[model samples]
Target: MANPPAVTVCLAGNVGRYKSSLPVGQLLLRGIMAGAYIAVGAALCTVAGTGVAPLLGAGFAKFIGGAVFPVGLIAIVLTGMELFTGDAMLGPLSVLQGKIGWGKVLNNWLWVYIGNLIGSLAYAYIMVWGPFTQGALGAAEPNAFGLNAVAIAVGKTLAYKSVGSIGLWSCFLAAIGCNFLVNVAIMLGITAKEFIGKFFGIWFPIMAFVATGFEHCVANMYFLPTGLWITQLFPSLVDKSTKAADGTVTYWSPLLHKFGGLTWGDVWLWNIIPATLGNIVGGMIFVGFVYYFAFRNEFPEDLMK
Candidate 1:
């Protein structure tokens, strides 16, 4: 058996209340765990999707990445860790339900977001020195996975940088689409009564967002830095040139040539900041507000009490 719509909404708001009431230490700790868990999924997607595009085609590669990408979210949901994107919806919903104030919601978001960033950066550092590189940290060459990380980073940031404001708008739109699906998955997770049901409930929408090429801020926190670290460590890899028999340059990585390399500015300016703002709107307004209004009248009086 599953929760009815009204019951699920009430439960979600209650969960939000509980989350917002957590101590700062607990919030940060859980946030870190959630961030690492998400990074684990992102890493798996990267490794799993490697070399798949050319053989199975881009669509299949996307499907494969999407299919594996939900593992982190599943872990977070089941274990009760804090994720900023989910909190973006949950905290606001709690506020709407009068279970918490905006201040509490903001506090939760701030600490959780910081924790998520710290965890992501930590995991990215681990990945850079571990699987992504084959040798000692300082002298290592980026393995195939590392190269792919660089490419992924470049695509996420520089691709947007190339086009300026329109690119930022595009990223913002993609982020809204991302967190919208993410919170939909969160709602399904709450609605399901059984583990298997919850698993599939969360899986599909998360998969859809990733497969559809939407921008997710938390996921990008891991993706961008992993790529940036690789490129920064191996500066020569930033731009590769293919020379003809006559020693004339025939090919260069278009992104590397155009933008040079991923920078902190590019990562924040082009992707993360816009993506974060868009995620807030997507989750807080699209899912949180919409669902609360839809179900507010029907919530059991006992739930409110």
Candidate 2:
């Protein structure tokens, strides 16, 4: 059965307290696992969605990608690993409930975010060398999935960079929408008592966020780097060309030329930074604070203990 609202909120606070109290090493280790798990889903999405846009419509392609992207969160929730976006809500909720202080909350965020980065980078490296490339890293061409990864990275960064400050705002807003759904998924996961219930509870909202093309900081941790590494390793792929029947060569990667190849600067400035900030607001304020205040008075005394 599902938990009542008050019970769920209290349970969330309890989970938050346990998370915040973990030592730095535990936080980092769990964070690394969570990051890699998220990358697993992202890799699956990239491979699954590749070339589907032409065969199916763009919408169906998106749905296919989104449909597979929840494996990471499902794994994380069931296994008790830490995710930064989820922590953005859970840690603050613990603070609101007087279960932990803001200092511990921020501490949890800091270590977990760093660990997530490390894990994502590790997975991205694995992808570039493993499935994304045709053979050895230096000599091999990027596979179809790798090429798609490049396109996705470009869309996330250059598409935003093209618009200046407004681009940052757009990324930020999209991130808000992303984590709002993410935490909603987290809440649903908490409310469910059965494994199958937890699975579907987390799946739908996560699928919604990805299909809608919202920004997610941790998932982007995987996506941006995978794209950036592929582009950097295969620089020729940046401005691809095709020979027509009449011997005319056309450049397909217009944005790549306009913005240059994906840079580390572009990754941070355009997507992760703003997305992280927006995720904070979306989770900490939008879901955590809203739900906490709504049920703070209703939490039973035993539940608080």
How far in Å is the alpha carbon of 81 misplaced in model 1? Answer: 0.3
Error of 1 at 238 (Å): 1.6
Task: Give Cα-based local distance difference scores for all models.
Answer: 0.91, 0.93
Error of 2 at 135 (Å): 1.8
Residues 215-270, candidate 1: write the lDDT tens digits: 99999999999998888888777567778889887433578766777789888999
TM-score of 2: 0.97
Name the lDDT of candidate 1.
0.91
Q: Where does model 1 exceed 4 Å of error?
A: 136-140, 245-252
| Residue 283, candidate 1: C-alpha displacement in angstroms | 0.6
Q: Which ten residues in a row have the lowest lDDT in candidate 2?
A: 134-143
TM-scores for all predictions: 0.97, 0.97
Task: Encode model 2's per-residue lDDT on 38-62: one tens digit a residue.
Answer: 9999999999999999999999999
